[model samples]
Target: MSSRLARTSALTVAAVCGSALLVMTAVSASGNTAEEPRLHDIQGKTRISPFAGKQVTDVPGVVTAVRGFGKARGFWLQDPKPDDDPATSEGIFVFTGEKTPDVEAGDSIRISGEVAEFYPGGEEAGGQSVTQLTGAEWKAASKKKAKLPKAVGLGADRVPDAYAPEGKGDEGNIESLKLQPRKFALDLYESLEGMRAGLRNAPVTGPSTEFGELWVTADPGENPTPRGGTLYGAYDQHNGARMKVSSLLPREENHFPKADVGDELRGATTGPLDYDNFGGYTVRATAMGELKDNKLKRERTRKQSKDELSVATYNVENLSPESEPAKFERLSEALVKNLASPDIVALEEVQDDSGPQDDGTVAAGKTLKTLTDAIEKAGGPAYESRQIDPEDNADGGQPGGNIRVAFLYNPDRVDFTDRKGGDATTPVKVGDDGGKPKLSANPGRIEPQEEAWKESRKPLAGEFTFKGRQVFVVANHFSSKGGDQPMEGRFQPPVRESEKQRTAQAKLVNSFAKKVEAIDKDAAVIAAGDFNDFPFSPSLDAIREGGVLTSPMDELPADERYGYVFNGNSQVLDHAVTSPGVGPVKYDIVHINAEFHDQASDHDPSVVRMKP
Candidate 1:
């Protein structure tokens, strides 16, 4: 027998009730599921279906929604009569391959198909799986219209504060385990998968994207930041109220609202709860709410005091001279106005003059010159640039763009102590310069040859004299989270495969900071740039492991600690950590980008002020 037959044969039926409407069931069962094979029986109480990998006949439900567009087109089938159990959902997605199913809302139907778990990026990818029926064939059981089941209300009250349940072992796959919808948010969403769901007057936490999607908070009170965003404060807290919003309205209608952060989707937005690879559980809205704009504004950081040496970090998003003049102007204005033109600024993703032209050329002098010139044009200080260009395209970013971290400093405020012998392979070492500490090679790479730095931008260390005091600033752009599995992947807890290298990279940067302080205990060392990880992540923990460096954002209020926004959660990715010697530091994650529709760069710049 075939594998499918063998698995089906494993389930022994005690008896058949009738001939035409045959009811086949397992020998030992809790309820007569065969007699009434509703949507709940297929969904069960767990994430994985109880009848997964087996064939089922005459599963009954009402056509609640139909998805006519997209590669996987199908209609949602929801049972009008629900079971007493809240753990099992009454809805199921019947996958009809590429063709849109010939079905409509309020149609009572009976479907027969193979119950299978659809892992978005495959089971091996370690993402959560969606329980769906494939190769489905259905017939309209009722000629008359059937009432569509009420959409499950999703709000702060329903979705539990806990994010997800831990798996059986380290793998964290909660597929087979029973769901506790009242205790865990993931379980709650899983229980309502493919079911009609609605949120009333939802607050938009993430702005609408070009891809016709936005994110909203079911609970507006959950870890809300000052500027209309849900704060992701810790590892355990992923802001359970966050959910993606994708409109089901036809694209030709042009009815989707363009909303910014803090806006409210007024009235009721109802839709089927669907799962995808990008943002996990989403509300594919059949009835979208009207956009109520709050006219949210951007924030600016205060200027540094005369005695304070301000250092800032900004990822210019692969900036090159070839970029639009508007981009350069906007970035310069942001640096000078929003960020208050800090004394030292660490710029990440500064591409070479050729900007993604994959030739042998790797010089970025013209690129830095354009930015410095723009800053001056913007009525800011005449900032000078210092950066060691990587060898060709060794550092990863855009294909031809030799993106590297570069520093821009006002010569009048600080002096860059440029030492020789710094290159892509050469490591910067800490040395004693008289009574103070100094780098053997200024503007040097930190452990560039290490495997952790492979295909990643190396930390650019530079020595500067701020008011006759030796201060060190390290600019970094660690490995990106390209290979990491999605949070809603097949695995219960998504694996961060890219974090290992980042952790190692963080350790190297930490050791460098420690060495500077080791040579002179009171050395002012500021490590700032695109960390590409959260404050609570292992990489950031490793950076602060030995108490050598401390992130200043920790001092800020939990709600005001974020510098970047992703999906809908306003979180931290860029940071500026200082040594203990940099006393009485002031930091601000200047909100100019990330929250707005029109942005200079995807990331917002951060500034830190300290008396060296």
Candidate 2:
């Protein structure tokens, strides 16, 4: 499966195919007068072209690269004679429809076409538009081959520290803003859009994705995490160094490198800088780089001590009985070997037995059984499952999959406290048992009817006992970042509209945990799962406020805080936090799945070892 950014590329394909009208405008040689604008004149200084929507005759440039395959067939053209301005790019893309453009890289051409700002996935997509000359008709200006323009070097010295210009809130776009290439990275990229760009020995920040793409950083020192991936600490710190790299060569012929984090794209990787919806700015490589592996290895956390209770959170990405046996085996192996068989595991995306089939089967008994059976087979303890199944199709996920959070506890290590009467809509409550806090409904949903959890998974609160002491754990699969605008979108400091729901969810989780603490100040309450927002995000801030619970990420080293990688940035989406009652926990965010191309789930499981 591809990352969220890559998944949006499919929408871009449709956008490109629809723009293939190729309107051949017939005028006269008067259209080819000396007053014809150059490539930079059409590009202008801002993101949106000045000549947009106007039919211009004989725009001159040489073909730099050709994308012959796919529905959005096009060629990049570069003017050999460039202007002094750094804001206006000398190169631009010429969009040809279904047929490949009859032009070679060396040929100098003068094209007549309408300058159009083509949004890759439509204007409503909230992404930056690609300025192209569509319906283009051209003639060879010179038979003599011209040398390609020198690729502008995008090394550490050139890329800016700042990311983008501030978004014009009500206006919604930065298209009209003048380019400040030296001050902001986004502006720098916009200034050089559709132009020849190069990266030398670029450090791989994100692993090679399934969509034949990878993320690399030109600036080596831009918030470099200890694990080689770039750090995305906050919204304010959008790392300017990150750039997506895709090959211009056709899929069947091109051999994109398979690389992990810490690897290097050896030598100079030259390409025409293009903007797309998938990844904000991309380098469509004409000369691809060689992979230089740094031998980055997967990590394993130390096992929990005998007296300590080990709890782990893993999103077994939509696992069901219909899933491949290999997936079960891999997940089981990771649980047993990598995590050292934690006493309690909070699993997210536990699908129904029938998987994606919309047959109204909501129970995940078979799915849990299959996973537990695999764990036992993989030399782990025999685990028991606890979960409150949601109403049919009420939760949002794969149509009939009905994914929900479930707990897997080793019977030999811990005992599950089973309180009856837990159902889909019933809210879990903290009840006073003498002087201690007790769960009113063990394995119960936390405010399932709340508006914050409209189509999202309800938080599952389960009570367990380890060594005669009662322990409370709330497993959550919060609302995803589905509808949020891309970080590289037209709106600078792209708006995270999905954050509101997540923040609301976080407050609810915080309230529930606080109640457990209020009943007993020393209650060992833990909340963990896929929050689906960064640790520095407002959602996380809401959870950490008022000194109720402390995130284990605070104890972790700055560089080792991430459990998931997205768009090449190592960020924390899955997290675990403990009430003040739980003291001195050793936390580990295992690096197994997110870094490797072959993986059981996209998120890496995190383990917290503490004496409850």
Candidate 3:
């Protein structure tokens, strides 16, 4: 790695000096060129190394932000898109890197590096499979170059750094599913809250009734695999939760030695980590944070920039608007003030018109509307929202509250197609509980195969066009609590088919892509949303791992890969997978959302961009 690459973080540089199209013969070491290159012939003009190689050239874009993992930091950039998931490179392609920073989201800079692909158990453990932009030597490249391509966009694929293969991206009982409700009603009085670092035994904080609380075996070799032991401090939920942790053992992995015994560890939400001790193992966790009373609370205010948009997501802290319409309105305003309203915002844990008590009120479930109106009233732009009316039968969160997902957008900025309630087949369903399926007369198992469920989560899919490029996006939340078949609790590996959870979801996504292809064989799919799993899980691996869809997130920093942490390890659950012809665009973290979720939601919102 040369000084340019070093200054750019851990990105490897690939060599292809003359691959560029229409470059002047006279070149400088800085590689800064004023002539803009055509993107349609990108394949003929570009070169990328497999790994740890070098690339000699420069692409222009801006650095979005820098997220620190440990020793290395990830540099997420906002590059232009050529076409929606199209490799033709017709427009600016947004790209992100795993190394360091050389640009900002709004900065116009160019970097030339080798692009590589990533696969689970294949290379670099987990990273992008194609165009792993590296060895990036950054400098000012283009300033208002060519017009953006309409169909061009960046890939939206990613890996989970925490809660994975063993319990993510696929179907499994979401222990947190139970805690989804009672956000503020949770009763966790004495457990660790928030991100605690560099310590072994963290003191308990006042309890709150949330869901980060989990169970693990202090002695994996004991008679029962998960015999309860000492309380593992409460650093667990990916977003935030109200948990009850009373037993814990010891762990040799302590990333933050400076983490004290008890200081209400707060920073980016961290751990609920599971460790393997020989054949035996110990389970631990990272608590999002114990409940705290906020008197000086603030919210994220929307800030739009030229040629850029800033969007963030989170399960707002105790802001169940419908639960308490008046209070909800107050919090709604706070949210708009704090979490900036972006061009498009995808959110989960939203309320539907189910009504407070499932009563047959005409407006019983217009939760999204109420909040949307309230947010707009709080000094924001007019936004349109969409969500499934949650099953009235399921006992999720607040009484009759919908555990539905929603996408609110500024229609003036982008175009969205309505696609819901299609009755399309799903590869699998989230287990009744994160346990073994119950025997029934149905052909498909009601419960996710514990073994298979450990891999991934049921995914939600959609597509949106930004500046003319249609990008496919998927939103998901993988399994949170890991356990054996209910009533038959024991640490047991699921049947091989259980791992099929990932395959199932991946197939579903593929099916969706096929549907789009039917509409336009060349249509690019941008699958974006939380996956609830990781890069290596069989679910993600089954996708176009063979030089197909691109995952710009893999090219990002390690710790930054994960939207949230568990027991210390980072997990990337949020993802954006695009069909070919999309991707190679600039990607970056809109970290504003995570700060609001210490007992709020369990995941963060991740977004990607490309110019049309």
Candidate 4:
């Protein structure tokens, strides 16, 4: 007999001849069959089980996995006779108490339980609802271990084309959508939730570090980023292409394999699909393959030419005097060794000396001093810093932090043309200086009190002369996307409410750049900082609306454009936009951070070199 037939025959024999297999009791005195139904009847045809709220009985399956120690004590079981439809999953979690289950893997048993939809990490966390069998009672049908089901291979061919549905109404309602397993990846994963699946020869897109999780994509990924991972598109297009591997076994026994980008998980990784608080759908690995590191290295940019000027932008993630001394030391190394010490660097999230202490101290002299001193100690140039401190707690970061944008320039390479110092309330105007655009205040705030900048970091504009050429620089740290919906959230085409403020801020900065061009048509202008939005986003478009400033990142190859990674996708959040007439430019995104476990900052810095 064929293997399929043999398995079918064995299941039939167990069902017909097994002891007490046909017994069923009503959950209450009502004697209602609906109250206690078969596992197949409970599974039904949709993502959620049909008998979800009702008690179920005589649900027969083989034990697949057991989690006896965690806060969520459970074991997963899969039915031998699965329905032909792909939408409904045959496997279901049995929520045992803190006590361990009196069962082992490969044991064919009949269970009496309540069918429930357990939402992990509570409902408010936007966690996925997992259908499970709770308050369960089971009795073994066969002591003889039956052969386990073959692992469902999740190869590239099995991956769906689209990541999620297009419309909003059905985005979070995964249970209601019609399953198109072959067309959409989200649909495919939703169909297979709580089922045994396997990945063969998958590439590790993200390594397990602090979270003990590994993100993998099928080899030769679709919509691959320059760094070998997938790109998160506008409409959550890459959500289905990546999967997180999590192990439920003891940490020592299931130590997550350490591998970087381009590494492969060879052989076979088999696990039961689950949805948790982290990445949406995770595979709790019961078996893992060998991890092979591809030996990825942190790449350094080409050194700046003597005649050319190099500028860089870095978001230090709320750096202050009170921050760990080691963080400052590591950041200095990244600036000197990795970035090669650019002529001018725009810094974001530089906090006051007292850091998050809300005592109304807005000055950051001590904070900047610590950083500049560290850079100089690391063999970098002695950089001079300039910034306008915002009102305490007015900026929307950590309270009392007074986080704002600032500039660090190598005094030996550039000259800060100090015109007039502008305070927090000053409105720096774009004026005509002999037909060249001139800033009324050399280092001034750009519409600091504007409604768009309400409780946000104001853009800092400064003028500098390098190689006898005057260059305009506007350092910006726009309103963050804190209010925006998560990319993996229930909302389809997630709402980015913060984009409005960013757009307004971008228009204001664009106006300054245009004013500079109006003064000197061919003048070099650089606007660089943590934009807090993607290069292709609408906010960035607002900055380039007048065609005065353009993203040099766009000139880079598609794969090399990203300076940030979110949800396993390499994307650009920090950017530099240069004036139209700049020539012979070279841009590099130094990947010193973002990908590593020991990163000093969450963002990677980008450097640009061009003739002024």
Q: Which candidate has the highest TM-score of all?
A: 2
Total clashes, candidate 1? 6
Q: Model 4 segments beyond 4 Å from truth?
A: 1-34, 38-44, 68-73, 95-128, 134-148, 168-174, 225-227, 233-239, 356-361, 419-421, 486-490, 581-584
Which residue runs does candidate 1 get wrong by more than 4 Å? 1-36, 489-497
Tens digits of lDDT, candidate 1, 12-69: 1121100111112221112223333678998898777777776778888899888776
lDDT of 2: 0.85
Q: After superposition, how far is residue 191 of candidate 2 from its true place, in Å?
A: 1.2
Model 3 C-alpha lDDT per residue in residues 1-612, reported as the tens digit of each score: 124322332323221111111111101122333223322223221211112223435554444333322222334333344333221222222223234354443455665654322111122212111223434466766554343212110011111112111322343322112111112111010011111111222222221112223222111211110111122211222212112232122223422222211123232223321111111111122223232223213223345555554333444322343466664565455456544566666565664454444563222236666777887888877878644333353413445443544566778786766632322132322122122221111112112233333333334444566776655444443433232121111111122333355565565555545544545544555665555456666667665454445677767754355544332223455666666655355555444322222323445455555544
Off by over 4 Å in 3: 1-304, 308-321, 324-339, 355-365, 390-402, 417-463, 474-499, 514-524, 543-548, 567-570, 590-598
User: Best lDDT goes to which candidate?
Assistant: 2
lDDT by candidate, in order shown: 0.83, 0.85, 0.37, 0.76
Clashes of each: 6, 0, 161, 5
Candidate 3 vs candidate 4, lDDT winner: 4
Q: Tell me, what's the RMSD of every candidate? A: 7.0, 5.2, 26.7, 8.7
Candidate 4: global Cα-lDDT? Answer: 0.76
